[model samples]
Target chain A: MPEPLFLLSPGRSFSSVVSTMIGEHPQCYGLPELKIFSADTIGASWEKESRPGSWPMQGLKRTVAELQFGEQTDKTVDAAEAWIRERFDWSGRQMMDWFQEQVGDRILLDKSPANTENGANLGRIVKAFPRANFLLLLRHPRPRGKSQYSTISKVLDKNGIGGMGFEPDVEWKWTGTNIMARQLGQDLALGQFMHIKGEDLLREMDLYLPQICQWLGIRDDAEAIEAMRHPERSPYATLGPVKAQHGNNGKFLKGPALDFERLATMPEASRDGPLDWDETAEFTPQTRRLAHAFGYR
Target chain B: MTLVETRPAPAALATLPGPDKPVALVRFGDALYVGTAAPDPMGRGRIWRMPWPAGGAAEIVYEGADGSAVTDFAVFESQGTPVLYAATAALGGGLLLASRDGRGFGPVAPAGLGQSGNLWLGPLAIAGGRLVVAAGSAAPLDPEASGARLLASPDPESAVWTALAEPGFGDAENSAIAALLATGAGLVAATANPLRGFQLWQMDPGGGWTRRLTDGAARFSMNPAATALSAGEGELLIGTGAPARPEAEDAAGPAAPEVIALDDGGAWETLVGEPRFSPEGFKVPFALQAAGFGQRETACVTAILTGPGGALTVVVTAVTGATPGPFGQPGLGASRLWRSLDGGESFAEVPAPGPVLAALATPEGGVLAVAGDAGAALHLHALA
Candidate 1:
């Protein structure tokens, strides 16, 4: 088994498509966002913060059921649940080893941006796979801010959870998530991490992707590059099997076609919006510093 | 629309314990019922009832177990008697209902309930003698067929709850009933699924529910989501906002916040929230704002109430800072009050602390509003 390549990003950072595209490389296997780094032990999922039946555990069960059993059926789900029960106390490194073995020969690719919420969470991934290459994903603060709000806006419309509709609130939340991720990745060994802007990946996939392939030490040949083009062809591309319905991005699950053209039209990030979220609320010093470092104005 | 006078509240309202936010407020008979999000620790939600107009200490009427927000609420007549209905977040928090004549409050379990873990029951309405409710749930994760449900109790007074339409509406995960309206023509409901945009469904006079307005084959474009449903003189008014949720935003639809009007089952026309949801239309924050990026959030129609003879319509919209505004970077962030003088037509901003959570039309034609964030700041306005 080869060392895995991990994607570190905030929610809504287009990590899903990129990671899956990388996994679609003939020499790699895209592991579902195992989120194994969230806890010290696998059973930690069921007992996180003393709240049993957490989403992580549920998500993991679904993932294992689909990936290991090769299908998410009644029997396969039972098998997955039994498997978890059998290895309840396994450490994070142990679980990663098991997945790597299962993904034998193919380099394992894991990207669960949610795990990076706590900076220490990435340390678990680092210790577990010392040779892992960490790819940092970024998006413009402005468009990312609008996107972050879109995620919560319908929530009030659906369940009546209050206080999430504020535009500044939404933007700040986006800023914090991205900022934390960027700050956390700064300390990694230069060779172990690389930064990739979402817009660049989208508008110039042909340009950036080959460089990423070269960096991964994988074949940059036409055939290997062609394989990454059809992420939809991956077994787990379109929604995962029944039990493990998601191992990637929710939006990409709709079709999985990588259309760089659609992302090309995104207007340049602007403090001014038709929605008129406080224009004064432009990129703060912290976000501005990071955006500037990433080559944004 | 213009800003009107701001007056002190006729009386102070009790606050929910801790951060148990006030999620729903509705008028029931001679009393206004306030529903609060469940308190911490126990996660027990509460309902307080206060006598109308003449202010006094509110009485705690119901305490719900689970972290149920008591999100959807309605008090309507059942066989000429008042019946109360409430819904909560997520599956297993069963639909709650109580008849004024029945023994007491209890869970109303619809048949085949508890089928999905994602269904958090919300959106309630009374139309055509039927008590209607919409369940918020994601579509089945698999490609297998299923969706969020639109349910109707032909007699909410009875134990009968059935689907208004077939099982599937849109992609179950993204699809939800955003608003409901009971009109003389039919019981209308609006649905949003990022994939299909937004659609209008009507339970007709013949007891059959059918699709009314939709994008047809163009499932690729922006479908304005409808919320803030209200009654207008001889017409129905619907408020809209941009599709909420980053996952849904992949459609890149426009956030067009415009209030739409329907007259005698006629064409649905842009009423007050036009071109841009410029303050008066009681627009729900935003619908589809293509160019303006920063303002996609921050404001939403929190509540809609009516004055006597249904001549005056008031919408309470709130805007609060999550974090950015704290640094003195202010956008269109403020809880505001908007009014419609000619029954959901022209509008104006009124004097009041914004992000007005709820409002009730006083019998004297003034408006009693529950504004401010988390059930603070109560105020009353005399319509001039």
Candidate 2:
């Protein structure tokens, strides 16, 4: 079986849209934010998701339904939940194998932001699939932090918990995740992993996507590339059944299409300014150094 | 001229050690040779060779002692065989090494031409049936009469180096010769004078020398050194800036690099830089569409290579000081590659692999660049 390609990045780095587009490629099967790697087994993962405020298990349940029943609905989602409970002892690796088997020879792509939150999560990935391909997607920390705060603030506002001294600290998440992904590169073969800035990819997808396909030794012909343009065509692109309404970002699920105009005119914030959440606190020097290393000023 | 906003990715031939700075690249025999300056003891200023037309892992051909660097590489005909000449930059003195084959090398000239001050030799040119070279001081800009020395040798194997011009071209402030080119006019040498600006001097075939552009070609001393020189269709293309390894006082000085053209009739035209009126007549930048080449930062035009079909590739870098950023240090300023197909009328930016230190035209109609961050890894990449 071919090794899966894991799109790894910090939260709010365009991983959802980019991964969905790449998964739309004829040779790959893009998975939602399974968040299954946080624990050793499917049961453990389910238990972890049961905790409040944890990343919901909607993505995992929806993926099980879509891949097993070839369609996602209320009945299929319930069946998917029961299916997971029946296989409590199944390891995450076993779960990935079953999904890969269902997808045939297509390369499985998983981009779980939570996987990078824990070193053991990434280690589990490499140990389970030693030959897996890793794509470390990066975003300029300034925009990443801003977008992350925007998403969190909107949620807090909707929940009537706005401005309750809940400051979102995005610096650690952005830097820590990318640093872990870079360390992951050291464990892989030379050509088995790559690091690409999300901004560059979105700006010149026509120029870089084919290069990426070539890197994966996949078909880069026009038809195959054209298919990748409409990431919304993916079955998981929309909101799932009410039980599993979100396996991805809510905004992305609402309108999961490439916004060329917005991407082209995306506001660029320099890495050297004070934090948006706190006016007095600036980005740590180490964070700025790492950002500079990634070719961001 | 056609411009591709998105440049195609080029193949990486090799990656030198983190402490190595790739300074020179030349095509010899069936392979491309790369020379690196390693300040650390482990690197030893190594030279590497990769198979041409079929690039793979590059093997180290020669390695120098600690604190030495391969400054430049030149190919010249010795009898019927083409000999490779490698210049060394060292503390005590520089050595000119020669080899009939690319692997093994022997000294062709005495270290520093027997002058301890001439610790660096480079910018070799073959003109008037003789091998001409310039020797100067490296970093920490030496002030011990180790200033620029222009030398020529009719019989290089004999190792007899004759001074073509006085030390520092008779100016103590002219610490080094940053660039040399054999043009239709003669052997042209550009000096690195941080004090009085860069000066261009040409030695004619009749053993006569003439100062072509003085006071940085009317741009004043701001243009301190001529960093690169290349032959145009019917003229000489000169790239001016502060030296890569600059003097302490000149490191933080204002520098807006420029590319000037010199015709055979001794006329001058500024290709890129501030448009001004000067002794060179009313000067206007031909590529006014690309003033400063779209770079607002203080930068220097480092290397220029004119290839087949009138394609010209120029490497520009913002002077980030002598010590390039290593793994832990702040990274060096990014380098940009601009190419022109209609002479200097318009230029298109080509994405570079890293901070390009030097560039050379390949035999296969491509541009090979020696790019690296100082004290960081060096990479040899081809620009298509």
Candidate 3:
């Protein structure tokens, strides 16, 4: 089976769009946020992460529906869910194997942000798939924190996700995921895990995408690179069936096309400035150090 | 001078016996002598010589007991006869050995020059008609006396060593003098500093030591050491990188290995590093090749050997494969060798016979490189 590519990053790191873009490569099959590695077995992942209106399994549902049945719909998604439930004891590796068989020669990519929630989650992924390629997706802590706070704070406030005094501090998640991913990467081969600033990738896809392809030991020709530019062409780039409505970020589902204008005009964030989203928010020393390492000033 | 055709890659000469890592190499009287050590620092050290035109088998001239390894070699003219001197890092400390003929060798100075902490002696140079040796401790044999010290002896037989300056040239952070070169202007020394960066010092004929370059000639902490030095036509080329600790790359960001040149007029120019702004000035790579010869994972340029007819060879320590182990240990990788036919104008990659540990330029314009881990081999790059 082809070694899969995993985009390891926290939320709001452009991982969804970037993984979709990378998946649109001719030789790759980018799947939705299949948060299957959260548990050793698929059943545990389904049962443990269950919540009202929070259908985390939608990604895996839409993924199986599209790849296994060739189209994602109510009936196909239902069949896909049945197939997954039947293999309730299936390990992440087995599910990955089944996906690889469905994709055939193309490399499978999983960009589940939740996979980077903790070191244990990353350890689970590594233990199951030893030769998997990890892309250490990075974003400036400034922008990353802003997006994370604005998006997640509203949801937390309205839904009362944590049930009490749930502070919306994205600091730990952003820094923790990057640190965990880097620690895991250091143990792998030199080229096994790569780091690319999401801002850099968005600003200069022509310059970086081929470099990424070359690192993966894949075709970096004009045709392959051109295909990657159309991430919207991925089957899961849009909203899936109502039953499996979201396997990815909803905003991305609405406008899956690459927004070059917004990307080009994205405001630069300073390393030691007040965050625009939060009035009193200041990055800690650890966050600042990591930001500097990622070429952010 | 003969105009030679450009060749694609270097050719292997002979694979020697066990004790794989080749650390030091020098040319002596039509033969190339390579000093080999077991991969372990304290393992046995052996010197082997290969005949020129390099078809003959490499013969071991001298072998030290376990816990010793030859670190460097320099040839000096003694009373109208050439004598080869080898610096060995041994358990007892550093030893200076001299041999008039390749077959026989004897100690020139007492081990460690009477300082037991100087466990490693390297960067041997003949400066101002004196033998200069840079001595320091690679391991903490004696912490109090561990900093680098420059030892000079006017007469090898007498072995009366004189300190060029204080240990580490008066800076405790300058842990080792990584390289020494007798340039046209003066005797120059490059110190390896962990806290700051590599500092370049020069001693004029008047015996005045001046700090020529500081903060790795403006590269700052990235260049912890200037590992190799070669004298150019009216210029001195210094190769900079932190070679001591490659696995610590995660802790210390990647080393930007650079070959910088300092002219007689106190001017600096970058020969290999990419174009970047420095405190000194806007430095640009003089060579066509990218930084570290296009390998960002390259840790250091180990040797800069200049041969007859302006031929030069640059050997680099590179991380070839992945860092596979759980502790983030680096993967098995080979050092690289690049050749420059037009002085330091441009360079072309010579597919190394193996991971080149040390390389030396032959008098006949051929380059000899030592490579391998279990049992090493001698590779020859001929101008065909």
Candidate 4:
């Protein structure tokens, strides 16, 4: 059997763009982060865990909403979510089966950056799908971590999730997730895994996209490359009214970039304090060492 | 710019043994030793030393205490004899074992090396005649008690191990020794204290150890923290990072605290910053090794970078490996090979393969032996 594609990374690491791009390929089908395998059994709670607010659920909701609902209107998003809950009955494998039915006999790409944080979940993934292929998407940690904090601050502000607490210790989360992935990569030989840089993807899309397609055993024809250009055309583009227009035609459909500088400068006690870039301005030698190791030095 | 395409090797390189675990690559004499964590039922890990070219297969060389996995190993020349040290830990805790001729290894506990049931050793490094090991508590220990202790062996043959220094800022529980570098100044150890952040401390023979850098809070978090210490033209270079950390708010924010250089006086400067050095999404650094470059030196760091693309790439960076660059710029290039002629102030790219897991300097000139998922591939480049 062909290995299932698994994207391992922290959130906001360009997972959406890359996954959608891969999904755009004719032979590849991109599914949202179902995160269903994290549970031991499929049930109501499992369905609950697959909701939009929870980490694992968000990706699934988004994927389903985009595939079924097509737009972010309240009616469409609710219908999509309801459709997903009813279809899979919270069984990850069932969902996989459903995906296979939609895409035919091609490899299914299930991407959930949030799953990267939980080593146990990753273990479960490997156990459930022994033939899973892992594509680790890496972004520069500094900017990515900072961006996560900035994003959280905005989310809390808009949704009234109340004041953010301790910034969720993002630095530790980033390291922990990466460490787990590295250890797993070591445990699983190299042929089963591949690492792609997000910066390279954005800056050198043509080069890396083709490279990824080659690794996935997909056709590297011009048609496949052109398919990636219109990611919005994928069935899994919009999740809710908020995300309805987000991904359409293979393009990133998101709101304008916020001024993270202002949020990053908030005082330490403020909800966005930890996100303050200047407050945490010193680079540890350990970080420098990592940068140098990655050829960033 | 022209794209260069290299033909694939005629034959597929030898694949790693089943149950692929992290392997430490070291060079001894004419052979490159590949040490892997063995799946011994007793828990003691075994080291399989294979001959370089024969690639015939793996041969078990050293077995740790009662089947407990060997967490780390280091090779250093003691006097004129070569000694190999392996950190062995089982359910009982951790111990240091030494092998002289690659065979039987016995416990080499030194004086004043406290016996804590919670000790866990991570990475190992050897420089000069001294051996530096990053010792941490497998579990929480006393705050007044030192968890992360720097142990040094004056001579490799002697079983005498002495505590060189302890981190000043926090307990080993909050902080674990990530990496150690024997620089021109002295032996500098990088400690990552989740509560205190990351700090650089220096250890001297007589005066003991002192804090050299303690701005870890200024950076983000230090998770699965790993470090590499190497010497450049005139400075000591140290590299470290967890999977993720807060970056500079600006476009050219501070580099991920991946590499730093310490001067003779024990002062450190940032050699690289965010965007340039930090891996996108999450990337945790694991291994570091340095190779001498004529009179200069270069080092390679191995890490895992996770991007939003939901893929993890094993990244290996080559740096001055010795000196601290000017204006905090250490080196450059995102390729597998990078060179720094003007000390470490600047770096240029040298093309190499993808997802490099480890690199070692060749005994021959201008050649690097790189191993990755693709296969055991070797690339030769001009130092200039």
Interface RMSD of each: 20.0, 18.5, 9.2, 12.7
Question: Per-residue alpha-carbon lDDT of model 2 for B58-80, expressed as tens digits?
Answer: 77888876667787888988887
State the lDDT of candidate 4 residue by residue for B229-332, as single tens digits.
55555566655543222232111122233444556765455444321112122211121211111101122344322222221122344332211211011232
lDDT of 2 at A283: 82
Docking class of 3: incorrect
Cα lDDT tens digits for candidate 3, B1-384:
234332322234466767556777888877778876656544678888877554577788988876777878999887778999998877787789999987788787788888877877877999899889989876211112256899998787687889987888888878888888887677899888755678899998998799988866755555668888888666787887654333434433455478888887788987786443343544656774555776767467867777656567777777443322111113336676677777777887766655666666554444545555557766556642
Q: How far does residue B54 in candidate 2 sit from its true spot (Å)?
A: 2.7
- For all predictions, the C-alpha RMSD in Å is 22.3, 17.3, 12.0, 17.6
Ranking by lDDT: 3, 2, 1, 4
Q: Cα deviation of A162 in candidate 3 (Å)?
A: 20
TM-score, cand. 4 vs. native: 0.42
Which residue runs of candidate 3 sit more than 4 Å off their true CA positions? Answer: A1-297, B1-13, B53-55, B79-81, B139-146, B244-251, B307-311, B319-332, B341-345
Better model by TM-score: candidate 1 vs candidate 3: 3
| Better TM-score candidate (1, 2) | 2
Task: Sort every candidate by TM-score, greatest first.
Answer: 3, 2, 1, 4
lDDT of 4 by residue, A1-297 (tens): 355788888776778767877887888887765666666544543544543653335555565655565644657666766786576554566666666665576788877664675776788788877777888786766677777777767777878774755355665555556656755754564346656656656665566677677666688789988887566666556433453333322224442222235423422221223334547554444444443333232
DockQ result, candidate 1: 0.01
**lDDT, candidates in the order shown:** 0.57, 0.73, 0.75, 0.51
The list of candidate 2 runs beyond 4 A from truth reads: A1-297, B4-12, B39-43, B139-146, B243-253, B289-291, B323-331, B370-384
Which structure is stronger by lDDT: 1 or 3?
Answer: 3
Q: How much of the real interface does each model capture, measured as fnat?
A: 0.00, 0.00, 0.00, 0.00
Best by TM-score: 3
Q: Rate residue A110 of model 1 by lDDT.
A: 78
Clashes of each: 42, 1, 2, 77
